[model samples]
Target: MPIATIILAAGASTRLGGQPKQLLTHNGKTLIRQIADAALSLQSGPVIAILGSNYEQIQPELADLPLQVVLNPNWPEGMASSLKFGLKALIDEPVDAFLVVLTDQPYVTTDLLQELITTQQQTGRGIVACRYGEAGHLGVPALFDIRYGSEFMQLSGDIGARKLIKQYAGDCAEIPFPLAAIDLDTWQDVEAWSKRQGAGFEDQGTQPKS
Candidate 1:
């Protein structure tokens, strides 16, 4: 099955004092590039990126990568807006299913994405989401069959793929990914994560984006 991918990188990073998380360095490459590479690593379909906020600066970081870039002018509206645009871009493509990804998740691996695809194919479910802790918040790095494309288009405001995951829970399959719970949303988050990995990020400044 041909699986397409959308990497959501349009957030303004308000929580990080205006620094674009997508440009943050990890494993020698920008976060955006890392996630984009992971998506394309699947080699199953086209990878599209939704860019907003500091797109000019962030674009260069991904200039050498192979993926479609779509600008979300309504990015201020929130995550759902970017998702809607990305889904619209893929509506005409030839794909069996599409995966929605986030750029700030440094731990999201190509392996996890492949698992989502594998589970979807094996279970024949339209949606395959990562199952985390007790809150049971199903989220991206998720794969959605083309059949549910319309539901994605209906999303609005700050909502994201999670909304649809819950709306159609009966048809979804879960993959345990506690690592998905670790996301870089704030300076403290980065600090804590960096310490956990002992990545020598202690001197990287405390201003979140710095």
Candidate 2:
């Protein structure tokens, strides 16, 4: 069974003061590029990027990379819209499982992604999420068995896969990832994380470009 990775890059970064965070150069590459690269390295299946907002600027960043780009017209609505668009686009592909990831978590490594895939395969669970504890800490970078494709397409509003996780808790597996919680939402967040990482704020190595 092949695993397909959907990089959710279609968010309106209103909190970031209207800047498209995916295009922010945390290092040499943009956040979206870094996340897409990591996802491609881990799984050999098709990798799709859901683009919205400043799609044109970010589209060029992913050029030459082995990825499929799907524009989400309803991206302005919410994150769930992008997920639905991406999943619907791949309905005919030979996808056995789907790994939905965000382009903002610079700390998410290919190793962690591979581990999630392995765990999902081993347990044959319906949903596998990276646990960040009780703030309803569920978001992208989640792997869902193909069995839940219908449910994925039904997602709406600002909701993510948490509802499915709760509904299918018995069939879900949690992979604890503390680093996954460190996402860049604002310039202050970037500065604080850089300070904590003991790296210079100007250094892009500490930040992931998606």
Every candidate's lDDT: 0.86, 0.81
For 85-122, candidate 1 gives per-residue lDDT tens digits of 89889877999889999988888989989999999889
RMSD of 1: 2.1
Q: Give candidate 2 regions above 4 Å deviation.
A: 133-139, 200-210
- Model 2 pairs in collision: 26-204, 30-209, 31-209, 31-210, 32-210, 100-141, 101-141, 103-210
Candidate 2: tens digits of C-alpha lDDT, residues 125-155: 8788888845757545688988888897788
Cα RMSD (Å) per model? 2.1, 3.5
Worst 10 residues of 1 by lDDT: 200-209
Error of 2 at 192 (Å): 1.0
- Candidate 2, residue 159: Cα displacement in angstroms equals 1.1
Assess the local accuracy of residue 184 in candidate 2 as a C-alpha lDDT between 0 and 100: 81
**What lDDT score goes with residue 182 in model 2?**
82
